[model samples]
Target: MTGGDEPAPARVQAKVGAAVLAGIGPRGAEGTDGARPHSDGGAGARSRSEETVDVRFPFEGTVGLWELLDDMAAAPRLVVGDERVRAFLVDVGRRLRAPEVARRHPELASLGFFLRRSELERAAGPLPGAAGSLPGAAGSLPGAAGSLPGAAGVGGAGEFVRVPRGLVFHVAPANVDTVFVYSWALSALMGNRNVVRLSARAGGTAQAILTIMRDALDDADPVVARTQRIVSYGHPRPGARRIPVEPPHKQLEHASPGHHASSDHHQGEHSGKPPRTSPVTHPEPVAPADAGSGGAAGPTAVLSAACDLRVIWGGDRTVNEIRRHPLAPHARDLTFPDRSSFAVIRARAWLEATPATRETVADGFAIDAYWFDQAACSSPGTVFWVGSPIECAMARDGFAACLAEAVARRGWTVDTAMAVEKRVAAYGLAADGVADAVEFHGNVLAQVILTSPGAAPRRWLGTGTFAHARIGSLDELADVVRRKDQTLTHFGFDRDELAGLARALGGRGVDRIVPIGNALGFHRVWDGVDLPAELSRVITVQ
Candidate 1:
């Protein structure tokens, strides 16, 4: 059976070393992990004896649940201690950081770094989100992680206890398979049981990671295993729908970063239209609400209803659609909705770079663009080269060539569909006079178009689709910035210039600005929020 209909009968079997005992085909009763008969010493002992349950795998198949979950009622059954959580992350990091592991699984590279004990310490620094401010305050300020009026660590902030939000539901994106792990890590650290919903179109990476997690975590810490459930089942079609780029023929403009164009009815300035007037494009692909209800409403309904925190990641449309559904009164929502990002390279810097420097820049930028095939939210889709039209073009073209070579050496596979899409979009823009010229690499390499500032689009450019625009100076970018413009990958620019740009945007522009090649690096404080702090509740003892 494809699952999702009803709970099946319990299965029992003994496990032998690293071998998969096949399921007994539909309610036939099959396998076991050597669980003893559990008893509560009550009249309900018979019902409580069978604790293991079959849970659907987040990628392709299903696994028994015998784990803990909070159905939005009482507290979570299993509580993972901080030490246990840290140990699990360490184990995952050790495995992922292995040379052979990295060679076979490049997708999990960032996860390794993120889970590294030393790295995690640096990112957390004793207390990850301990600020002398109230919760929900200071969110407007960039890098301003909100925290209670105390610190949390081995010796400090003892009065302030970070309480888990019970159960967290993670709806991870398909393009980046490891994202779910990143999201889950924070909640797990806070001792929250999690149920991550991977994309129905999950790649093999999800399965591979899950298998390793199963092997390493089984019985090592019952709290870790029994508290978390990584699940995936058929979700509605993706590509068939998308977060709309703009509303019909209207083109919304952005002024400097310090200021915003206000429209009372506008949904988001980035989308280029007022919400009331903008059309909802994707409606057929509903979220998985209640599979137990026989495909009623949305498959996520049951999960959402039972969860205390819902971390939604996908596109803007998905975020908005999910918001339409109500959450538990005590629940909270954090969404990594559709966002666009770009890179800003100083032409003089690139043009004046020594041969070795140029090659290194190419390699770094290549990592940013090529990793995740540019499908990640952090990947820069448009590059604004700051310099004269002639010089900028020269720098852009040179960088493209160097990047192509690097990508080939790295053996980066281009998404054929996205490549074709880039070609059509570039040529289409040129034909419409929006782009001055079109650049296409038949090598399945990359595409960069020469266009005016703000002419570069956020959507439509998938994997290899890149856009370029000439800017006379840094100030020109202010007019082209959007509300959702996330990362500003730059080179040849000093701290002052970048800070000035951030100030000019009034803190409404890029939430993160990194060196040219570090665009895709994950941060503990992402999208302008302290994740660990935001995911947990800080009770002020005072």
Candidate 2:
């Protein structure tokens, strides 16, 4: 989903060293249901005693939960930006870009473009924060397949060596299905073995994506399936009781049912030992206390305690709910919380734009607003016009007309429930004296005239409902911007003007300030945080 108050939110080869670390067989073979065998050689088939979990992508059908995690941990480790993984993702992107798929799911097309080799490489290249290294920087190591061509190694003090953060657990948002792909893809690109949790109600776009990925996996190296997984399970009700954990012994048992008790320093970097020749063996699977109940041993809890990182999406409520499930001491979270956005247009610019250009802008605005039903955190909920009162009123009227036409042209409509919701919200604002006028164009669009710029509503107001207010200058909005404000999409503004507004805000709010059409464009740096930098950790190797 394009980021509002509430937003919904591959493959590798095997080396002997990797094989040993991964505890898998040398040859690639099929497992039950046509899925590839587990990294534990062919044990993947025999281990399927219970099919409780749904493996949605790369493979489908239920599998024994423990078997899945064991395979993930045992899979051959990948250097950041491993070529095999890159190739697999690129293949999926190619499939997504197919005209038929794009026509059906425009969002998927955007995702396809984001997954392009060029874009991936660029993101995997030099990143913010780290003194020297970035995700995919493993290429700088000796004998590693170059992750980034022409990238340099750590040179001196202040330089660092970057490596994958190990198993990453992603909790994807329900409303925006494709979001999980982006979160998991980047983490995987950085060589992190991933387990993504999709909503049980994931939409068709997500299903289509899973199919593309599974198809791409067919020809990918066996390591791909061994390392990555997409699973969907029922979320335990809120306030579910937490599992009680015992203190760890020398070997820490992950708080998952059937998880093997293993030493902490499994990675070569920590162990400082040569890779073992034979696959690492494990003890028999033991069910945790409260295994079947929504307690500590539940899938979410198990994943939380087992992962090195947890990427959370949804909003404040989801973040808080997941936080109840404690993470391993070494694991941490990267959260995307509730945020709202607004649009800004210069009255002069709106009036001066060519009819075609104005139409195009309106169409783009419709996309930003309607793509996710304006429930995404990035969806613009209000419009700020800069001009005299008379000019602002004229521009508002003209823009409304164009926007309505654009919405109709795009066939975007709000159902009766949403339409009624918009009316209630709009009328409530008017009754409160915050909005002087409320207008609706059929069931597709609604406009509310705010009493003042400060009166802009931050909460969602149903799809296509936009609050309008005028300001004398762009700087005037700085006073109204709050920490919860995220994206500020605009038109008829020069770089200097936009930059000035951002500077004026001085990081108080509005992390992203882009042109209206690009409001929903996903980037490596989101919410002012460099994702590539955040996903990977740096070892200060002076």
- On TM-score, the candidate that comes out on top is 2
Candidate 2 lDDT over 1-542, as tens digits, reads: 22132211011111111221222211122211224434642232223323256666555455555556655655678767677888888888998998766666676778999888888887777664544344335432311322332235433344455678888988887666577888788888888889998876665566678767766765676667667888776643233233322221111222232232221211222111111112111111122221333221346655665677888887676777676556655678998878899999999999999999999999889878877667777889999999999999999999999999987776555677778888998999999999989999988888999999999999877778899999999999989999999999999999998888889998899999988888778887788877776777666543
Tens digit per residue, CA lDDT, model 1, 173-245: 7666678888787777766778887665655565556655654553245456545666654443333222222
Candidate 2 error regions (>4 Å):
1-51, 128-159, 235-291, 294-296
lDDT (CA) per prediction: 0.59, 0.69
User: Cα RMSD (Å) between model 1 and the true structure?
Assistant: 16.5
- Whole-model lDDT, model 1: 0.59
- C-alpha-based local distance difference test score of model 2: 0.69
Error of 1 at 293 (Å): 5.0
Cα RMSD (angstroms) for every candidate in the order listed: 16.5, 15.5
Residue 424 lDDT (model 2) = 91
Question: What TM-score number comes out for model 1?
Answer: 0.73
- What TM-score does model 2 achieve against the real structure? 0.77
Clashes of each: 25, 10
